[model samples]
Target: MNELNPLDRIRELCEQRKWSYYQLSKASGIPYSTLNTMLNKENMPSLPTLQKLCQGFGISIVEFFEPDRNLQGLTKDQALCLSLFTSLSQEEQQLALAYLKGLSRTL
Candidate 1:
């Protein structure tokens, strides 16, 4: 796996939240234009901007910068399962879980 930087981390955070850049800008109280420009330019955020992104993600700067995957308390498989589950509709999720439960009983 590649080393994740603050930018990559913040993007993943936003994606996990199903947020648009505009949504993140509103949440972070940062200007949408600035956020767009910075990200498009591949420029790292200033400390203040980084802090705002962290705030938007409901994480402290330390947690945002923490490179350890284990801190999330999920195995890679679990994380993949969760992300896939999140992409499903509420009814689809319920049905999928029910099917899994049924299959488990036959094991």
Candidate 2:
């Protein structure tokens, strides 16, 4: 699926939640005019702004980064594992895979 820009995602969230820009701003403690400008002009939020939005919506940074689906659907441990896996060097990846296979054999 194509990814929506951050502002587009925020706009969609607001519409789905039946929230006005002012309501979102109030909820997020972001300035109403800034939120309005972002939504109206399709401007991307800064990292701090995105963080505030996620916090206001009772969500995590991973959730905000996932444009296609809700992050709440994934367990915290699963997300953490995935993050760690994706960051591994190629050699480290091979080592981890081998370790897992060895553990599986023992079990």
Candidate 3:
């Protein structure tokens, strides 16, 4: 696997979401100053910090580091749903799944 720069990956994810660093800081529960200093100095984040970032990005650490995989099988709507679901907090995700289960049961 090619070595990827974590900072560049973070920037790419932010660009994909059209998010500012402040937005990321809020989502990741990271302080803006720490994030800014890390990026400005090109310092690598420790594992826990990286985990917070991955959580904020709605992805796993494996997904964050892995090369992009083909997602062509998903329809646009399905992909959108997945993206929205991933962005939710853990509790919200569980609630969403329960709601979907309830809806499915009515069918």
Candidate 4:
């Protein structure tokens, strides 16, 4: 993955959270025009704006600049499993788990 600057990182996190720029602006109470300028101009957000984003996400400002994938969260395997489970139908998941459990009992 390409390295992301602070603005890029924030944009990515917003996407990951399923937030639009407008959503972030509204939730953060930062002016939409200011946010648009910061993002478009690649200028840094004001400390207050940064604070609002960090607070909105329940993370610290320092943590926000860290590698996007390296944020304190699930391991890759855990993330994969989560993704897979979400894709499975409830009955398919139950049957699959039951089959695995049966195999475990026999071993």
Candidate 5:
């Protein structure tokens, strides 16, 4: 798979969260206007800006650079589900698993 530009990564991260550029600005503490102009351009964001973006995505820089979904072979839904599942309590996790199994039986 071709690599995404850093700016592309930022855009992809925002898209995955169903976030508007404004939401990213709020989460990253960057100005919305700045992000809007920067993300639309070819210029790479500065390291500090990148850091803020990573923080907004709740991922490390290393994870940021990891292979994206095309290479990782996870569909968008699976990736989102995994992320949400990991954030749940153990009891909630068990409940979700049971729910999935029950749903599958009805399918």
Candidate 6:
């Protein structure tokens, strides 16, 4: 497999969310100037910073690097559902799962 550029990955994630750099800065809790410098200067974020970015994107670090792997064989709607599901809070996720289960029983 070819190597992935971290900066490009960040850009891709931001684009996926329809977020501008300023929005990302707010979500990631990184100063806009710092984020701007890092992206513009091609500087890689440190581990903690990367973690914050993943958190901001509502994903884990593993998902950040291999986003498509798990979703590869899923239908678009399934993938979208999974993406939306991951963004929910823990309690919300449980409720969603319960709702899905109820729906499944009716089928």
TM-score of each: 0.61, 0.58, 0.68, 0.57, 0.63, 0.73
> What does candidate 2's lDDT look like per residue over 1-32, in tens digits?
66657877677666655667787787689999
For candidate 3, lDDT tens digit of each residue in 1-107? 57989999998888767778888898899999999999889999999999999888778898788734434588888878876775565567889999999999999
> Cα lDDT of all candidates, in order?
0.76, 0.72, 0.83, 0.71, 0.77, 0.85
Candidate 1: lDDT of 18?
Answer: 76
In what order do the candidates fall by TM-score, top score first? 6, 3, 5, 1, 2, 4
Query: Model 2: which ten-residue window has the lowest total lDDT?
Result: 82-91
Candidate 4 Cα misplacement greater than 4 A, ranges:
1-4, 67-107
lDDT of 6 by residue, 4-92 (tens): 88899999877756678897888779999999999999999999999988877778888988887789889999999997776565457
Mind sharing the TM-score for model 5?
A: 0.63
Q: What is the lDDT of residue 90 in candidate 1?
A: 43
RMSD of each: 6.4, 12.4, 3.5, 8.6, 6.8, 4.0
Model with the higher TM-score, candidate 2 or 4: 2
Worst 10 residues of 4 by lDDT: 82-91
Instruction: Please identify model 1 stretches exceeding 4 Å from their true place.
Output: 1-3, 67-107
Question: Which residue pairs in candidate 1 collide?
Answer: none
Q: Give the Å error, residue 11, model 3.
A: 0.6
Better of 3 and 6 by lDDT: 6
lDDT of candidate 4 over 1-107, digit per residue (tens): 55547788778767756677887787677878988989998898778889997765546676676533433498888777644543344455678789879999999
Higher-lDDT candidate of 1 and 3: 3
lDDT of 5 by residue, 1-107 (tens): 76758988887777656678997888788999899999777768999998997876667787788734333778888877877764454456689999999999999
Q: List where candidate 3 sits over 4 angstroms from the true fold.
A: 70-107
